[model samples]
Target: MTNTNFLISGKLIDIVSREIIKAELEIKEGQIVSIRKKESVPDRYILPGLVDAHMHIESSLLIPSRFANLAVQQGTLGVVTDPHEIANVLGEIGVDFMINDAKKVPIEIRFGVPSCVPATKHETSGFVLDSNIVESLLKREEVVCLAEVMDFVGVVEEDLEVLRKIRACKNLGKKVDGHAPGLKGQNLKKYVASGISADHECSNIEEALEKISLGMMIQIREGSAAKDFEALYPLFDSHPEKIMLCTDDLHPDDLIENGHINYLIKRGLKKGLDLFSLLRAATYNPIQHYGLDLGMLQLGDPADFIVIDHPESFVVEQAYRKGKCIYKDRKVLFETNNDIILNNFSRKSILLSDLQVKPQNGSLHAIVVKDGDLLTDSLLCEPKIDNGNVVSDVENDLLKIVVMSRYDNGKPVMGFAKGFGFKKGAIAESIAHDSHNIIAVGTSDEDLLHAINTLIDMKGGIVAVNNGDREAVRLEVAGLMSNKTGEDLISDYTRLRKFASGLGSSFESPFMTLAFMSLLVIPKLKLSDKGLFDVEQFKVINLFKDL
Candidate 1:
């Protein structure tokens, strides 16, 4: 239990005034009542709790409440999240689940209206939140902004439906986020002109600078796979106010092993960036931009602040939300309930024949993946024929990749991919990006069949199958997150990842890379449940080159 009235003293670091001074704070009824200057105080430092500018809570593989249980320990008292992943699976019900579950914790979680429900026309999702639905969601008190508008092409080409969604947000005085990677010049201007004010997809400082010049906020991202912080960290010095920190799609292992926004702050400090600038980017900028009700340790504001050991070490010793102690001494002070379970999976087991692909007359287009990048490349390679059917060329690092609709028993769409470095087994997950379908990659049809079936039997989760062994972590909530405790989820996910690595994958996060295989919104080449998509051309294309 928390006392309604209390007093604390510390070296308060004022981000707005850019100063640190010894002070005593008087708190009452979850609000800061007054601040008094002190001659001497404790050695600890007090600062506003961190805030994630933009992220997908589902990407952590834990439900909103469980995510809060871990994030509060890292001093994250507020988050501006986009429920786009689960929205693709269960639509409005998914959004409501996130909102209700978030209320069970002390963190302030504000959701956005998912702008792209199906993500793209070249894919299949369980439900669609059209313009009307988006407008309705925008009216909700908990909905603060419109999520990332992934279809940049539609905005650039003046698509009516896309414009309607943007207009709805604007009419309701809400901001619209962007997802245009490598988009520049007139196309970027048009995208910005359409009311998409911020983008977290800039890969380099040059791109970020151009976007900033157009009055667009750049969210420097360093998530599980798509790491852009190193390339954009210079923004701290160049355009501090125009920048914010985000981890667009963080996984459980990364969340547990490293940290959240705090990790970025530590990295920035190591790079010799200004501490106040980094803090402003992580806290004040996001809170102001999204109109979040989280406190900034100011008078009459909610008593949302954290106690750190010192500026050099920057270890959070205590985290308080609304005058309530939520975390202290390296332990979370709150417990989460695990009774809720929601999912939308209808996929069934598949046979070896379902994974077969007939040989084509020409070379095939294979999706090329990198170690820690979301953008994929296209490769043209000769298909290795076996029994008159195309087969994986394990020697050349070429493997079979498939995307199947988990909403129904549709015929699987098969394509070839390179760069997973898997030599023996197969890995599958229902956490595929945007559409959240079942995506698998393997060196053999039998292993791929087994891996995918394992996920089907479990309803939804990530699985690795090799020879006769299998390991998995179930995500029973909307096929995107689990109701498990953060520690349990992290342990299970780590073990599952190690088991996948034992199967010969060398990538740091192979399952995360596999999830994006079906993200047709990204560049170069990608696969969808509908078929292999040519993103640059913005259409589904034949896997085989024209004869």
Candidate 2:
């Protein structure tokens, strides 16, 4: 027989037993063969590899290759990903990119079939996946579940199409992920009954507890815009079994500066959480929940674990995925060819005349983005009057927001949004959240047009076009990320932030802030590449027709 067994000797922290003991774990191919007591140097603490229960690789602003390179060094061996960002950009092809890229890496990457492509019918997504596409994707070997079903309202109402997709997943015995924000009472109960197994969108203790009580795994998400760690760390103390950790959407700068799973692990420790429970939540829970073929240091388990210099300190010395050392010394030794051609949605320059705002009448609803949360707060604002038309008011820091259909649909919806605080020019991005559409917000009509066109010229990425006098900062990768390293991306992002701040935005980072402006799935008010959307009503609110 071939030499299929290799011994990994270390002081093991068996997640199942919650103890540290000397053991030699054996591995044959991708599975764990056996474990036995062994004499060890005892210089390291070996624990089950960390598992990210939920995350978005696109948010890392790196393709799968670079992402794996950075993440493995931090002791992460697996990630449950929802590539909805790319799905919104390229549909089936985009989802394939993520899957193929993961296949090239040593880490175990489980996918969640993207449940919401455009996130909603209102947004302009590059591609669309119906029940047919979703059902097909769920059959993949690595697909673990249906991605976050954003259309909670649609599900409860038993929209035949939405329900059809749910039933389709059920037919395949796959899990359903939830994205219900601020849902409670009977609505919450009904939503739970729809078979969503987890929710990573909780922003407060109350919501976190409520979802956990209903038997849903609450992934404490600490991502770029949505930082819920501080608010829900208490869950680790009381309900450690039901909680897991995830970075739902972290930008490149944040990833390089703070790290991924390691960042959350350290934060939990500082919050006075038990080290054992933290490790369990970070590793065991996710493994058990997904039924992954991961090792947990037992009589027969793959020799997959990490050597940490200090367990309490949470410093990773070396990381192994499937018994192979993939990362050591804070550097990635392995590389995967995971590059794809970025598709450009901008056909031509968007002019001010094209973005000219009209007046709206009746009870006007606007999207309100709560700082530090992906959820939005809807508010009613008085319309600006201009020749019997509602217009943008730079004086009030209210700027015009537009969602252009780049998927070849000619329908364009324009809305007005306050709080962007644009002082002079405009900001445009192709990395709109959930649905990667062309979203632009601006004060100066000319700059708005120029900004949109500039993004079009680059094909994809975020761009800040200042007044007639300012320079444009371009992110030319996928319109969502910079192909440059984290350091270079941060420098460029810094410049864009400063430029946007100079224009009057009050936020610390403006370009990333604008990217989420059209995320109708979050809450309150948001513009898809379609028109003014009321998430509560889940309908398009006309900008001028109603007025």
Candidate 3:
């Protein structure tokens, strides 16, 4: 190596050795050429670039290129993203879309083959990534590990296809991520025994400890939908080496306001954690576990690192990928190009009468939404009925929720939800969890009709209908992402959220909360396009059935 293409001076953080020194670095041909100790350094601290151990870029509602731009300024040089959200809509093409889109940027995007398409048998999605698809994806160099296995039931039972997917990854010498929330004892033991290497869904510290004890890495997730940092932060003190940090489903607003992994580091430091422990979570752990090509700031390693003012805030001043300055002065330097490509969506006219159903009894299963929590409760409540049909009780803040198939014309599944707090109007989103159906919750049938119809007219997107006012953001690609600029996407999302708020809804993140409505794997009760689902029993039941 010659002298240097660029020279960086800072208090260098050595994540592998758990030490910091005032040093100067020499970069040549996108690789760190030399490291020299210096008596004085710039007013900055340099560390290995952070990686989101697991994330779904589609959840950001921006395409791969835009999401990368948002992440790089926050010091995320790479992400291990599962395109499972889009894969459910377009199958193999969806995964390929993510890979191809990622290639037009400087950030590292390691896509994982979605292990469970349709998520479960009780749901209807546009495509299914069966065992064959999983094997084919494993052969792609861009495909890293098997995405989070949401089907804990299949893995625990040693389901042949699920096991086969794991085998495919193992044969390729790749890691397998997990998503078993609230799993314990023999079930957890068996699931890990199948070679699932990591999990991002532990709700409690005990669950985190148990999984770690069984030789599995625990990814403490802090994202828009699920925030598990409070419960799992203790693990950093106990088992720092086995821990990784990730924002599995972050929203664009959160990404712009707070940083990415740097946000976690600030939160961890504020909570009085050891600096090195938090650093390892952000730098070394995920890269080592997934065998990422991202660097550890060593000589001859790829010069992927960030310059921060200090450890207390971990505010990224600049970020470099492969020795090229990508983010500087709080702005990401990436070319912007957004292209709209339609995948699968079915536009079917729906009427309010089509969603009407009479409860066999007075009590109905209502999904109780907890603020800032993904876990929901099934509440058996007496609903107000009109004629022979049960209706939304806005007085109690209970609203009717509908899940309609966006892939095909099907009878919309109806259920109820609690804590939405909207007295008059409806909010709809096409990016429903797992199955990605069009889901809407409304106080009135008229409003529900408008919301669902708006999404259908837009092909696939999110819309809010309040009284007569309406707002929407079209997600043309797989009905889960927008090709719009970041500013426009943020503006549209904010407008729709404001419209929902104007209707008296009292949720922190309404759109994301609505999106998770059909995630049957979470728990309690949920509605899918097929029918009302009892996640606890793993069975579809009639809403009119007596509990």
Please give the RMSD to the true structure for each candidate, in Å.
Answer: 1.1, 3.4, 1.8
Quality of model 3 by C-alpha lDDT: 0.87
For all candidates in order, the CA lDDT equals 0.92, 0.75, 0.87
| Residue 374, model 3: Cα distance from true site in angstroms | 1.9
Give the per-residue lDDT of model 1 (tens digit) for 1-547. 6647889899999998999989999999899999999999999999999999999999999999999998887778889999999999999999999999998888899998899999997889999999999999999999889999999989999999999999999999988999999999999999998898999999988899999999999999999989998999999998999999999999978887788999999999999999999999999999999999889988898999999997667788998888988899998888798767799999888989999999878899999999889999998999999998898889999999989999999999999999999999999999999899999999899899999999999999999999979999989998889989989888898889888888788898899888998898899899998999999998999989966
Q: What tens digits encode model 2's per-residue C-alpha lDDT throughout 374-446?
A: 6666667776677655567778766777677655645446777767677888888777786777778887667
C-alpha RMSD between model 1 and the true structure? 1.1
Query: Residue 408 in model 3: shift from native, Å?
Result: 1.2
lDDT at residue 483 of model 3 (Cα atoms):
90
Q: List, residue by residue over 1-547, the lDDT tens digit for candidate 3.
A: 1223989899999988889999999999889989999999998899988899999999888999998888887788879999999999998888888899899998888988999998998888889889998999999999889999888999888789899999999999999999988889999999999989899998899889999999999999999878899989999889999999999998887888777888999999999999999988987888888888899999899889999899897778998888888889867777869686866987588987897876675487788987778788888788888888788889998899999888888888889899888888898988899989889999988899988998898888888888778988888888888898777888888877777788886677888888887998988778898888888799998676475
lDDT (Cα, 0-100) at 167 in candidate 1: 99
lDDT of 1: 0.92
| Least well predicted 10-residue stretch by lDDT in candidate 2 | 469-478
Q: Which residue window of length 10 is worst by lDDT in model 1? A: 310-319
**TM-score, per-candidate, Cα-based:** 0.98, 0.89, 0.97
Considering TM-score, which of the candidate structures 2 and 3 is the better prediction for this target? 3
